[model samples]
Target: MLRRSKRSSSSYYLLRRIALAAKAAKGEQSRCGIVGRSSSCSCSRFLTTGGIDDGEDDHDASTSSSSSTTLIKKRINDEYVDTEAAMERTRMKAAALKAAGLKAESMTVFDREVKRAHRDRAAYLQREKKEEKEKKSSSSEGDFLLEEATRRVLDRLDDIKRPFKRILVIGGATVSTVKQLLEKRRDVETIIACDSSEATLLLVKDIVGDAPKRKFDSFPVEIKYVQAFEDDLPIKDNVVDCVLSVLGLHWVNDLPGAMGQARCTLVPDGLFLSAIFGGDTLTELRIACALAETENEGGVSARVSPLAHVRDAGNLLGRAGLRLPAVDVDTLTLNYKTPMDLVEHLRMMGEQNAVIERRQTIKRSTMELANQKYVENFSALSLSNDDDASMPKPSSSESGISATFQILYMTGWSPSETQQKAKERGSATVSLSDLKSALEEKEEEEEKK
Candidate 1:
């Protein structure tokens, strides 16, 4: 019974070996050079060449053969190596993708940083705009007050009674009083109104309204409107008798050039009467901004450019070849319930527009903080003054506002020889020291008055 059991086990093992060999032979046949079923050059034929046949004795001999065992072992080893190589290729591909993903993440971070920088820049610009609006509001309020003061001066000038032939009105839009004065004077022959703003010219035309034809029949006065800059007046040299301007000269960016142009356009004996904002124009606002910046490091702190710094003005006029230049400085105090209200008045008067270089937008938060700081500082300072100091002596030209502005009124004439001389070699030169001296003298005169 033991011998029969052993024979059965041997037979099972032989059958398994034969099956595996047949599978390998079929796989080789599919991949080998053998084409037809009749071909003897197949793996099956090659294995059978060593005197092996399909029988019980042959099968037992094949199973015991070392060559067959070694072949089977080699095939199993090759299959294991192929599986491992495939797994290794898949792992390398996954690692490469992870590295690429990390690089993309780094690029996204850089892009976010750039966008943040742009947003910061935009915020800064908005803040600048708000501050500019505030400045314009203040300037407009000051201008209205100045117009009233100018009216007084005009009344005084009219009372003196000087004869004038041809009156050249530069920046005629803002000088309504001067225009009225010329219209009333019968001796005035021609009024040449010059301005860059077409809207202003139209307004001036409306004010005159056929009066030049009706009132002055004897002189037949002509009102000519010239659209020109201060530097480029479209008129004959040495032809005008008097040039009048108010709240206009400060808008000219190239003051010297504009002055030189004015000199060229004026007659030898022509008088130039002008009023402009000066260096001390917005003293209160400037002080407020400075105090705010110092107290809360969050507010904007930039110096406001004076309407007309006296030294610069005098120098500019002298450079234009004007003689007997008399510069007079005056302070006009105006009262405003709030800073924002003051700004609205300026907008109404069309004086809210700033020069291109000074133009900017301001942030709401910055402006609110600045206003609060200003109120605190102003109140504290006003209260600190001695109560017995004679009730804060009233100035010559004081309005209701707590703030005051210094405006410079200047009058000068073109040198008699300026018309005859070459444009380059004319009397258009004034020393800086002389201009400084003139401003100092004007300030001193104001104090004495």
Candidate 2:
């Protein structure tokens, strides 16, 4: 009498377990009547055997088969349960991720907006550069202002009696500054032109022709072009003698970071000079858009990118590890034919709004009303100025609207051994009391006068 081994595989006992317990337990029959002694699962021999009824053995075999089947079923059920639980967990995680994505509002931020502005500006310049080149005159009003700013920086350099050897122009609009420097500051040896927008860079031909061939100091001035973000200049530390940006820093998201990089790129006593639009730029358009949106769309959206304050520029420079930071404002009031004309000029000049969280679309009515309101409120059109024939007009002054573009100028000098340094604690030559007395004496003299 042999019993099946308990350690047998589940597959081996699977069929035996699936059968009825009574049938599987059919006991040891005669080995002589058409039966093989080695057979473990088949029950045909039980019925075929001659007159040997082992009912107890048959019951035991049936029980063993039933138990084996129950064990296999239990294992299958456990695996199925585990698989279902894992699937459920995966579904829950996916749902959570979807909800999280939906919850994040204002998907665009300032940095992303600036990057977009640069990319689009590049594309735009590439498309219209030929037209621009053909129509180029003494540059636009904005360009004139940038040139003036660059001149101011050059003058400041003169006042300091310092000469720049290597200069980096941080924005495409300031490419003229390089030529201006090369012509004016003959000591300058190299010029690095960097712009985030390739299209903007393409416009460099208008400012700088293939003309570094005009030698300086027994060698041709070196000209290098690199596409780089303001916050991330690709130059060695203390390599550039000056960093100049014109009508450009206003578009940067991280002004302080960019300024810091400028400081890092400059040699000791190097100068960082830049001019950017202040918060007052395009005030009329911003107001008109907000008013129209509120009147028509029930709420207002960001229609313009906010510019920086001149006051904040000084702090930004100090934080960038520069010395003697200076910030000042220069406001230029320009007249336009219409608000739309002003907008067109901005587009042409690559000054499109790069603000994140801007309105995806403006309603037709909203835009129409905005334009109407702009004409009514900002333009110089009186009731009598209306043409009943609706004749087309030429030039911006026809509609006669004025927009303010406030330019903020910033200057900071890279650290040098000769530059004035703050005195350490108790290191001053004069005591606090002595300084107070001197101030009092000065006030007394003024009062006496």
Task: Enumerate clash totals for all models, in the order shown.
Answer: 16, 7
Q: Write candidate 2's Cα lDDT for 1-449 as tens digits.
A: 01123432243345335433643355423311111111111101111112333333332322333321211111001100122222343356457757787421233246543553544443344334445555875333224434555676677677766677778888736555765776677677777676665444445533444445333554466665544455545455677888888777776665776788778878888998888888888788888888998998888888888877767778888898889888877655666676776665565455766666665577778888888887788864333122222322224343577666777778889999988977778877788899999999999999999
Candidate 2 lDDT at 171 equals 72
| Native-structure RMSD, model 2 | 29.4
Worst 10 residues of 2 by lDDT: 71-80
TM-scores of the models, in the given order?
A: 0.52, 0.63
Total colliding residue pairs, candidate 2: 7
Which residues of candidate 1, in runs, are more than 4 Å off?
A: 1-146, 152-161, 172-175, 182-184, 213-220, 293-303, 353-359, 379-401, 417-449
* lDDT of each residue in 250-307, candidate 1, tens digit only: 6555566566666666767667777777878667777766665555565444435446
Q: After best superposition, candidate 1 residue 322: deviation in angstroms?
A: 0.6
